[model samples]
Target: MAVNTSGRTTAVDRAYSALLAEIQTGALPAGAVLAEVEQSARLGISRTPLREALVRLAAEGFVVQQSPRVTVVAGIDEKDIRSLFELRRGLEELAVRAAAERGDAAVFTALAESFSAAATANPGLADPAAHAGYYALISAYDAAVGDAIRNDYLASALRTVHTHLVRVRQLAKDNPERLVVSAGEHALIAGAIAEGDAALAAHATHVHLHNALISILSSIAGSSQTSTEGTP
Candidate 1:
Protein backbone atom coordinates (compact mmCIF):
# COMPACT_ATOMS: atom_id res chain seq x y z
CA MET A 1 0.00 0.00 0.00
CA ALA A 2 3.03 2.25 0.38
CA VAL A 3 3.64 2.49 -3.37
CA ASN A 4 7.20 1.60 -2.49
CA THR A 5 7.95 -0.46 -5.55
CA SER A 6 10.97 0.65 -7.58
CA GLY A 7 9.32 2.47 -10.47
CA ARG A 8 7.04 -0.14 -11.96
CA THR A 9 3.54 1.31 -12.19
CA THR A 10 3.21 5.07 -12.54
CA ALA A 11 1.83 7.19 -9.69
CA VAL A 12 -1.59 7.54 -11.30
CA ASP A 13 -1.70 3.86 -12.14
CA ARG A 14 -0.84 2.99 -8.56
CA ALA A 15 -3.51 5.29 -7.24
CA TYR A 16 -6.08 3.88 -9.64
CA SER A 17 -5.19 0.32 -8.77
CA ALA A 18 -5.40 1.02 -5.05
CA LEU A 19 -8.78 2.68 -5.40
CA LEU A 20 -10.11 -0.09 -7.60
CA ALA A 21 -8.85 -2.70 -5.17
CA GLU A 22 -10.73 -1.05 -2.32
CA ILE A 23 -13.86 -0.81 -4.46
CA GLN A 24 -13.61 -4.44 -5.54
CA THR A 25 -13.17 -5.61 -1.95
CA GLY A 26 -16.16 -3.51 -0.84
CA ALA A 27 -14.20 -1.23 1.44
CA LEU A 28 -15.75 1.61 -0.53
CA PRO A 29 -19.37 0.59 -0.44
CA ALA A 30 -21.93 1.38 -3.11
CA GLY A 31 -22.85 5.05 -3.48
CA ALA A 32 -20.03 6.25 -1.23
CA VAL A 33 -18.97 9.76 -2.21
CA LEU A 34 -15.32 10.31 -3.11
CA ALA A 35 -13.65 13.66 -2.55
CA GLU A 36 -10.88 14.20 -5.06
CA VAL A 37 -8.83 16.61 -2.98
CA GLU A 38 -9.13 14.48 0.14
CA GLN A 39 -8.14 11.31 -1.71
CA SER A 40 -5.23 13.09 -3.35
CA ALA A 41 -4.04 14.35 0.02
CA ARG A 42 -4.32 10.91 1.58
CA LEU A 43 -2.49 9.23 -1.30
CA GLY A 44 0.14 11.97 -1.38
CA ILE A 45 -0.65 12.76 -4.98
CA SER A 46 -1.77 15.92 -6.73
CA ARG A 47 -5.33 16.66 -7.81
CA THR A 48 -4.51 16.37 -11.53
CA PRO A 49 -3.42 12.73 -11.29
CA LEU A 50 -6.21 11.90 -8.93
CA ARG A 51 -8.71 13.35 -11.35
CA GLU A 52 -7.15 11.33 -14.14
CA ALA A 53 -7.40 8.20 -12.04
CA LEU A 54 -10.99 9.00 -11.27
CA VAL A 55 -11.72 9.36 -14.97
CA ARG A 56 -10.27 5.93 -15.60
CA LEU A 57 -12.27 4.51 -12.73
CA ALA A 58 -15.41 6.00 -14.22
CA ALA A 59 -14.64 4.38 -17.54
CA GLU A 60 -14.31 1.08 -15.69
CA GLY A 61 -17.70 1.54 -13.99
CA PHE A 62 -16.17 1.92 -10.56
CA VAL A 63 -17.03 5.59 -10.03
CA VAL A 64 -19.45 8.20 -11.29
CA GLN A 65 -19.06 11.97 -11.39
CA GLN A 66 -22.02 14.25 -10.83
CA SER A 67 -20.68 17.64 -11.83
CA PRO A 68 -19.78 20.34 -9.30
CA ARG A 69 -20.74 18.31 -6.25
CA VAL A 70 -19.29 14.78 -5.89
CA THR A 71 -17.98 11.69 -7.55
CA VAL A 72 -19.60 8.69 -5.93
CA VAL A 73 -19.09 4.96 -6.07
CA ALA A 74 -21.39 3.60 -8.73
CA GLY A 75 -24.10 1.32 -7.40
CA ILE A 76 -24.90 -1.72 -9.49
CA ASP A 77 -28.56 -2.59 -9.50
CA GLU A 78 -30.42 -5.62 -10.92
CA LYS A 79 -30.69 -4.23 -14.43
CA ASP A 80 -26.95 -3.66 -14.73
CA ILE A 81 -26.36 -7.10 -13.26
CA ARG A 82 -28.66 -8.71 -15.79
CA SER A 83 -27.04 -6.98 -18.76
CA LEU A 84 -23.53 -7.83 -17.64
CA PHE A 85 -24.35 -11.49 -16.93
CA GLU A 86 -26.07 -12.00 -20.27
CA LEU A 87 -23.08 -10.63 -22.14
CA ARG A 88 -20.72 -12.67 -20.00
CA ARG A 89 -22.72 -15.84 -20.69
CA GLY A 90 -22.39 -15.45 -24.43
CA LEU A 91 -18.74 -14.43 -24.44
CA GLU A 92 -17.72 -17.04 -21.89
CA GLU A 93 -19.42 -19.73 -23.93
CA LEU A 94 -17.41 -18.58 -26.92
CA ALA A 95 -14.20 -18.67 -24.88
CA VAL A 96 -14.99 -22.15 -23.62
CA ARG A 97 -15.62 -23.39 -27.14
CA ALA A 98 -12.33 -21.93 -28.36
CA ALA A 99 -10.36 -23.33 -25.45
CA ALA A 100 -11.92 -26.72 -26.10
CA GLU A 101 -10.93 -26.59 -29.73
CA ARG A 102 -7.40 -25.62 -28.71
CA GLY A 103 -7.31 -28.28 -26.01
CA ASP A 104 -5.26 -26.25 -23.55
CA ALA A 105 -4.35 -28.63 -20.77
CA ALA A 106 -2.29 -26.17 -18.76
CA VAL A 107 -5.07 -23.62 -18.73
CA PHE A 108 -7.52 -26.25 -17.59
CA THR A 109 -5.20 -27.41 -14.84
CA ALA A 110 -4.80 -23.89 -13.53
CA LEU A 111 -8.54 -23.34 -13.50
CA ALA A 112 -9.18 -26.67 -11.80
CA GLU A 113 -6.67 -25.86 -9.09
CA SER A 114 -8.20 -22.49 -8.43
CA PHE A 115 -11.66 -24.00 -8.19
CA SER A 116 -10.49 -26.73 -5.86
CA ALA A 117 -8.80 -24.21 -3.62
CA ALA A 118 -11.88 -22.00 -3.59
CA ALA A 119 -14.10 -24.91 -2.64
CA THR A 120 -11.88 -26.03 0.19
CA ALA A 121 -11.15 -22.57 1.56
CA ASN A 122 -14.75 -21.36 1.90
CA PRO A 123 -13.52 -17.78 1.55
CA GLY A 124 -16.93 -16.32 2.18
CA LEU A 125 -17.22 -17.50 5.80
CA ALA A 126 -13.63 -18.39 6.57
CA ASP A 127 -11.56 -15.55 5.13
CA PRO A 128 -13.37 -12.79 3.28
CA ALA A 129 -10.08 -11.25 2.21
CA ALA A 130 -9.16 -14.34 0.24
CA HIS A 131 -12.01 -13.82 -2.16
CA ALA A 132 -9.90 -11.33 -4.11
CA GLY A 133 -7.40 -14.06 -4.86
CA TYR A 134 -10.19 -16.36 -5.94
CA TYR A 135 -11.55 -13.80 -8.39
CA ALA A 136 -8.09 -13.10 -9.76
CA LEU A 137 -7.51 -16.80 -10.38
CA ILE A 138 -10.85 -17.04 -12.13
CA SER A 139 -9.95 -14.03 -14.31
CA ALA A 140 -6.62 -15.52 -15.27
CA TYR A 141 -8.29 -18.71 -16.39
CA ASP A 142 -10.81 -16.73 -18.39
CA ALA A 143 -8.07 -14.72 -20.10
CA ALA A 144 -6.22 -17.90 -21.00
CA VAL A 145 -9.32 -19.40 -22.53
CA GLY A 146 -10.17 -16.20 -24.34
CA ASP A 147 -6.66 -15.94 -25.73
CA ALA A 148 -7.00 -19.33 -27.32
CA ILE A 149 -9.96 -18.11 -29.35
CA ARG A 150 -7.80 -15.84 -31.57
CA ASN A 151 -10.81 -13.74 -32.44
CA ASP A 152 -10.19 -10.05 -31.96
CA TYR A 153 -13.85 -9.09 -31.91
CA LEU A 154 -14.70 -11.64 -29.26
CA ALA A 155 -11.61 -10.82 -27.28
CA SER A 156 -12.26 -7.09 -27.29
CA ALA A 157 -15.88 -7.57 -26.31
CA LEU A 158 -14.86 -9.87 -23.50
CA ARG A 159 -12.32 -7.38 -22.15
CA THR A 160 -14.93 -4.62 -22.00
CA VAL A 161 -17.63 -6.75 -20.47
CA HIS A 162 -15.19 -8.27 -18.01
CA THR A 163 -14.44 -4.88 -16.44
CA HIS A 164 -18.14 -4.36 -15.86
CA LEU A 165 -18.56 -7.89 -14.55
CA VAL A 166 -15.85 -7.38 -11.93
CA ARG A 167 -17.76 -4.41 -10.59
CA VAL A 168 -20.87 -6.59 -10.33
CA ARG A 169 -18.90 -9.35 -8.64
CA GLN A 170 -18.39 -6.99 -5.69
CA LEU A 171 -22.03 -7.58 -4.81
CA ALA A 172 -21.46 -11.24 -4.00
CA LYS A 173 -18.33 -10.79 -1.89
CA ASP A 174 -20.36 -11.00 1.32
CA ASN A 175 -21.84 -14.30 0.18
CA PRO A 176 -18.99 -16.80 0.46
CA GLU A 177 -21.10 -19.71 -0.66
CA ARG A 178 -21.67 -17.90 -3.95
CA LEU A 179 -17.93 -17.68 -4.43
CA VAL A 180 -17.57 -21.40 -3.81
CA VAL A 181 -20.33 -22.14 -6.29
CA SER A 182 -18.64 -19.88 -8.83
CA ALA A 183 -15.39 -21.75 -8.40
CA GLY A 184 -17.17 -25.04 -8.98
CA GLU A 185 -18.66 -23.76 -12.21
CA HIS A 186 -15.28 -22.53 -13.38
CA ALA A 187 -13.84 -25.99 -12.74
CA LEU A 188 -16.61 -27.70 -14.67
CA ILE A 189 -16.13 -25.40 -17.64
CA ALA A 190 -12.39 -25.82 -17.48
CA GLY A 191 -12.76 -29.59 -17.40
CA ALA A 192 -15.02 -29.52 -20.41
CA ILE A 193 -12.55 -27.37 -22.34
CA ALA A 194 -9.58 -29.45 -21.31
CA GLU A 195 -11.33 -32.60 -22.48
CA GLY A 196 -11.92 -31.06 -25.91
CA ASP A 197 -15.68 -31.15 -25.60
CA ALA A 198 -16.72 -27.89 -27.22
CA ALA A 199 -20.45 -28.40 -26.80
CA LEU A 200 -20.12 -29.42 -23.20
CA ALA A 201 -17.84 -26.50 -22.45
CA ALA A 202 -20.26 -24.08 -23.99
CA HIS A 203 -23.16 -25.63 -22.14
CA ALA A 204 -21.28 -25.51 -18.89
CA THR A 205 -20.45 -21.86 -19.38
CA HIS A 206 -24.07 -21.02 -20.14
CA VAL A 207 -25.36 -22.89 -17.15
CA HIS A 208 -22.81 -21.16 -14.95
CA LEU A 209 -23.88 -17.68 -16.03
CA HIS A 210 -27.54 -18.62 -15.88
CA ASN A 211 -27.20 -19.80 -12.34
CA ALA A 212 -25.44 -16.60 -11.32
CA LEU A 213 -28.21 -14.50 -12.79
CA ILE A 214 -30.82 -16.63 -11.10
CA SER A 215 -29.12 -16.29 -7.77
CA ILE A 216 -28.97 -12.51 -8.08
CA LEU A 217 -32.60 -12.32 -9.15
CA SER A 218 -33.58 -14.56 -6.29
CA SER A 219 -31.81 -12.26 -3.85
CA ILE A 220 -33.62 -9.28 -5.30
CA ALA A 221 -36.95 -11.10 -5.08
CA GLY A 222 -36.39 -12.08 -1.47
CA SER A 223 -35.61 -8.49 -0.62
CA SER A 224 -38.76 -7.37 -2.35
CA GLN A 225 -40.91 -9.88 -0.55
CA THR A 226 -39.44 -8.94 2.80
CA SER A 227 -40.11 -5.27 2.13
CA THR A 228 -43.66 -5.95 1.08
CA GLU A 229 -44.37 -7.96 4.18
CA GLY A 230 -42.94 -5.29 6.42
CA THR A 231 -44.95 -2.47 4.87
CA PRO A 232 -47.50 -0.89 7.21
Candidate 2:
Protein backbone atom coordinates (compact mmCIF):
# COMPACT_ATOMS: atom_id res chain seq x y z
CA MET A 1 0.00 0.00 0.00
CA ALA A 2 1.14 3.52 -0.74
CA VAL A 3 1.26 6.14 1.99
CA ASN A 4 -0.32 9.53 1.52
CA THR A 5 0.67 12.59 3.53
CA SER A 6 -2.32 12.72 5.87
CA GLY A 7 -1.79 9.57 7.92
CA ARG A 8 0.44 8.22 10.66
CA THR A 9 2.19 6.18 8.03
CA THR A 10 3.53 9.40 6.63
CA ALA A 11 4.98 10.17 10.00
CA VAL A 12 6.83 6.88 9.97
CA ASP A 13 8.25 7.68 6.57
CA ARG A 14 9.24 11.13 7.71
CA ALA A 15 10.98 9.86 10.81
CA TYR A 16 12.68 7.08 8.89
CA SER A 17 14.06 9.42 6.26
CA ALA A 18 15.34 11.88 8.82
CA LEU A 19 17.04 9.26 10.97
CA LEU A 20 18.44 7.39 8.00
CA ALA A 21 20.07 10.54 6.66
CA GLU A 22 21.59 11.31 10.03
CA ILE A 23 23.03 7.83 10.36
CA GLN A 24 24.40 7.72 6.82
CA THR A 25 26.02 11.13 7.23
CA GLY A 26 27.47 10.29 10.67
CA ALA A 27 25.42 12.93 12.40
CA LEU A 28 24.02 10.06 14.44
CA PRO A 29 27.26 8.27 15.12
CA ALA A 30 27.50 4.53 15.67
CA GLY A 31 26.45 3.36 19.12
CA ALA A 32 24.38 6.50 19.59
CA VAL A 33 21.28 5.45 21.45
CA LEU A 34 17.83 5.97 19.96
CA ALA A 35 15.56 6.57 22.87
CA GLU A 36 12.03 6.31 21.63
CA VAL A 37 10.58 9.16 23.64
CA GLU A 38 13.53 11.40 22.99
CA GLN A 39 13.51 10.63 19.29
CA SER A 40 9.78 11.21 19.06
CA ALA A 41 10.19 14.59 20.70
CA ARG A 42 13.21 15.52 18.60
CA LEU A 43 11.74 14.39 15.30
CA GLY A 44 8.35 15.91 16.16
CA ILE A 45 6.55 12.68 15.53
CA SER A 46 4.37 10.60 17.83
CA ARG A 47 5.91 7.72 19.73
CA THR A 48 4.05 5.09 17.73
CA PRO A 49 5.36 6.34 14.42
CA LEU A 50 8.86 6.73 15.78
CA ARG A 51 8.72 3.16 16.97
CA GLU A 52 7.66 2.04 13.52
CA ALA A 53 10.53 3.94 11.99
CA LEU A 54 12.95 2.39 14.46
CA VAL A 55 11.72 -1.04 13.55
CA ARG A 56 12.25 -0.32 9.88
CA LEU A 57 15.81 0.84 10.49
CA ALA A 58 16.52 -2.23 12.62
CA ALA A 59 15.23 -4.56 9.95
CA GLU A 60 17.55 -2.91 7.43
CA GLY A 61 20.61 -3.23 9.74
CA PHE A 62 21.01 0.50 10.18
CA VAL A 63 20.38 -0.01 13.88
CA VAL A 64 20.66 -2.78 16.46
CA GLN A 65 18.51 -3.70 19.39
CA GLN A 66 20.77 -3.77 22.40
CA SER A 67 18.13 -4.64 24.96
CA PRO A 68 14.40 -4.54 25.51
CA ARG A 69 14.47 -0.77 25.22
CA VAL A 70 17.83 0.20 23.75
CA THR A 71 18.47 0.73 20.06
CA VAL A 72 21.73 2.05 18.69
CA VAL A 73 23.26 2.95 15.36
CA ALA A 74 25.36 0.20 13.76
CA GLY A 75 29.10 0.53 13.28
CA ILE A 76 31.21 -0.35 10.25
CA ASP A 77 34.68 -1.72 10.92
CA GLU A 78 37.54 -2.79 8.67
CA LYS A 79 36.22 -6.31 8.10
CA ASP A 80 32.81 -4.96 7.17
CA ILE A 81 34.42 -2.48 4.81
CA ARG A 82 36.41 -5.27 3.11
CA SER A 83 33.24 -7.30 2.65
CA LEU A 84 31.46 -4.25 1.29
CA PHE A 85 34.13 -3.59 -1.36
CA GLU A 86 34.29 -7.23 -2.35
CA LEU A 87 30.61 -7.12 -3.20
CA ARG A 88 30.98 -3.69 -4.79
CA ARG A 89 33.77 -4.82 -7.12
CA GLY A 90 31.60 -7.67 -8.32
CA LEU A 91 28.33 -5.76 -8.82
CA GLU A 92 29.80 -2.55 -10.19
CA GLU A 93 32.08 -4.32 -12.66
CA LEU A 94 29.09 -6.20 -14.08
CA ALA A 95 27.02 -3.04 -14.14
CA VAL A 96 29.59 -1.00 -16.06
CA ARG A 97 29.96 -3.79 -18.62
CA ALA A 98 26.22 -3.82 -19.16
CA ALA A 99 26.12 -0.05 -19.30
CA ALA A 100 28.89 0.09 -21.87
CA GLU A 101 26.99 -2.24 -24.18
CA ARG A 102 23.61 -0.57 -23.78
CA GLY A 103 24.18 3.04 -22.84
CA ASP A 104 23.45 5.97 -25.16
CA ALA A 105 26.73 7.29 -26.43
CA ALA A 106 25.55 10.88 -26.20
CA VAL A 107 24.62 10.51 -22.54
CA PHE A 108 27.90 8.92 -21.57
CA THR A 109 29.91 11.32 -23.71
CA ALA A 110 28.33 14.25 -21.92
CA LEU A 111 28.99 12.60 -18.57
CA ALA A 112 32.58 11.99 -19.57
CA GLU A 113 32.98 15.61 -20.54
CA SER A 114 31.46 16.72 -17.28
CA PHE A 115 33.82 14.50 -15.31
CA SER A 116 36.75 15.91 -17.26
CA ALA A 117 35.60 19.38 -16.41
CA ALA A 118 35.25 18.45 -12.77
CA ALA A 119 38.82 17.18 -12.74
CA THR A 120 40.08 20.37 -14.31
CA ALA A 121 38.12 22.47 -11.85
CA ASN A 122 40.01 20.63 -9.09
CA PRO A 123 37.28 21.26 -6.54
CA GLY A 124 39.16 19.13 -4.02
CA LEU A 125 35.92 19.17 -1.98
CA ALA A 126 37.64 21.12 0.82
CA ASP A 127 34.67 23.42 1.25
CA PRO A 128 31.02 22.48 1.80
CA ALA A 129 30.09 24.17 -1.48
CA ALA A 130 32.82 22.34 -3.39
CA HIS A 131 31.64 19.05 -1.86
CA ALA A 132 28.18 19.50 -3.36
CA GLY A 133 29.38 19.80 -6.96
CA TYR A 134 31.84 16.92 -6.66
CA TYR A 135 29.29 14.56 -5.19
CA ALA A 136 26.57 15.70 -7.60
CA LEU A 137 28.77 14.75 -10.56
CA ILE A 138 29.42 11.31 -9.10
CA SER A 139 25.73 10.85 -8.38
CA ALA A 140 24.83 11.82 -11.94
CA TYR A 141 27.28 9.29 -13.34
CA ASP A 142 25.94 6.56 -11.08
CA ALA A 143 22.40 7.41 -12.09
CA ALA A 144 23.43 7.12 -15.73
CA VAL A 145 24.89 3.69 -15.07
CA GLY A 146 21.69 2.56 -13.35
CA ASP A 147 19.62 3.73 -16.29
CA ALA A 148 21.94 2.16 -18.85
CA ILE A 149 22.15 -1.22 -17.15
CA ARG A 150 18.34 -1.48 -17.06
CA ASN A 151 18.28 -4.15 -14.38
CA ASP A 152 15.80 -3.39 -11.63
CA TYR A 153 17.18 -5.98 -9.24
CA LEU A 154 20.80 -4.93 -9.71
CA ALA A 155 19.87 -1.29 -9.35
CA SER A 156 17.94 -1.96 -6.14
CA ALA A 157 20.79 -3.96 -4.68
CA LEU A 158 23.28 -1.29 -5.62
CA ARG A 159 21.11 1.35 -3.94
CA THR A 160 21.19 -0.63 -0.70
CA VAL A 161 24.95 -1.01 -0.96
CA HIS A 162 25.43 2.69 -1.69
CA THR A 163 23.46 3.64 1.40
CA HIS A 164 26.10 1.86 3.43
CA LEU A 165 28.85 3.37 1.33
CA VAL A 166 27.93 6.90 2.37
CA ARG A 167 28.77 5.94 5.95
CA VAL A 168 31.95 4.15 4.92
CA ARG A 169 33.06 7.16 2.92
CA GLN A 170 32.76 9.33 6.01
CA LEU A 171 35.19 7.11 7.89
CA ALA A 172 37.97 8.17 5.59
CA LYS A 173 39.85 11.36 6.38
CA ASP A 174 39.53 14.24 3.92
CA ASN A 175 42.13 14.09 1.17
CA PRO A 176 41.90 16.57 -1.68
CA GLU A 177 44.59 14.67 -3.56
CA ARG A 178 42.51 11.51 -3.59
CA LEU A 179 39.46 13.38 -4.89
CA VAL A 180 41.40 14.54 -7.99
CA VAL A 181 42.61 11.03 -8.71
CA SER A 182 39.09 9.75 -8.23
CA ALA A 183 37.74 12.23 -10.75
CA GLY A 184 40.22 10.93 -13.31
CA GLU A 185 39.19 7.37 -12.56
CA HIS A 186 35.57 8.30 -13.10
CA ALA A 187 36.50 9.96 -16.39
CA LEU A 188 38.04 6.73 -17.59
CA ILE A 189 34.95 4.74 -16.72
CA ALA A 190 32.63 7.24 -18.40
CA GLY A 191 34.87 7.49 -21.43
CA ALA A 192 35.01 3.74 -21.91
CA ILE A 193 31.25 3.56 -21.63
CA ALA A 194 30.87 6.38 -24.13
CA GLU A 195 33.09 4.46 -26.53
CA GLY A 196 30.78 1.43 -26.15
CA ASP A 197 33.62 -0.81 -25.06
CA ALA A 198 32.25 -3.26 -22.52
CA ALA A 199 35.51 -4.98 -21.73
CA LEU A 200 37.39 -1.72 -21.37
CA ALA A 201 34.71 -0.19 -19.20
CA ALA A 202 34.62 -3.21 -16.97
CA HIS A 203 38.40 -3.13 -16.65
CA ALA A 204 38.33 0.53 -15.78
CA THR A 205 35.64 -0.07 -13.15
CA HIS A 206 37.68 -2.86 -11.62
CA VAL A 207 40.76 -0.68 -11.45
CA HIS A 208 38.73 2.13 -9.92
CA LEU A 209 37.23 -0.08 -7.25
CA HIS A 210 40.60 -1.63 -6.47
CA ASN A 211 42.21 1.74 -6.01
CA ALA A 212 39.28 3.15 -4.05
CA LEU A 213 39.21 0.30 -1.58
CA ILE A 214 42.95 0.67 -1.07
CA SER A 215 42.67 4.40 -0.53
CA ILE A 216 39.73 4.21 1.89
CA LEU A 217 41.37 1.42 3.87
CA SER A 218 44.62 3.33 4.02
CA SER A 219 42.79 6.40 5.23
CA ILE A 220 41.01 4.46 7.94
CA ALA A 221 44.25 2.81 9.04
CA GLY A 222 45.99 6.17 9.20
CA SER A 223 43.17 7.61 11.28
CA SER A 224 43.26 4.69 13.68
CA GLN A 225 47.00 4.90 14.12
CA THR A 226 46.84 8.59 14.83
CA SER A 227 44.07 8.11 17.36
CA THR A 228 45.97 5.31 19.07
CA GLU A 229 49.12 7.41 19.33
CA GLY A 230 47.24 10.32 20.80
CA THR A 231 45.61 8.18 23.50
CA PRO A 232 47.44 7.65 26.77
RMSD of 1: 6.5
TM-score of 2: 0.86
lDDT for each residue of candidate 2 in 152-214, tens digit (9 for 90 to 100): 999987888887888888778766666767778899889999998989888888888888888
**Stretches of candidate 1 exceeding 4 Å from the true structure:** 1-7, 109-137, 151-153, 173-184, 219-232
lDDT of the structure predicted as candidate 1: 0.73
Report the number of the highest-lDDT candidate. Answer: 2
Off by over 4 Å in 2: 1-9, 122-129, 224-232
Evaluate all candidate structures by whole-model CA lDDT and list the values in order: 0.73, 0.81
Question: In model 1, what lDDT does residue 16 have?
Answer: 92
lDDT of 2 at 8: 54
Q: Report the lDDT tens digits of candidate 1 across residue range 1-232.
A: 3334676777788789889877765678678889988999988999987888888888867898766788998876788778778778877887788878975687787778767767776334246677567666866886787778888888888887876665555454245566677777888888778788899989988887887777666755555322110000
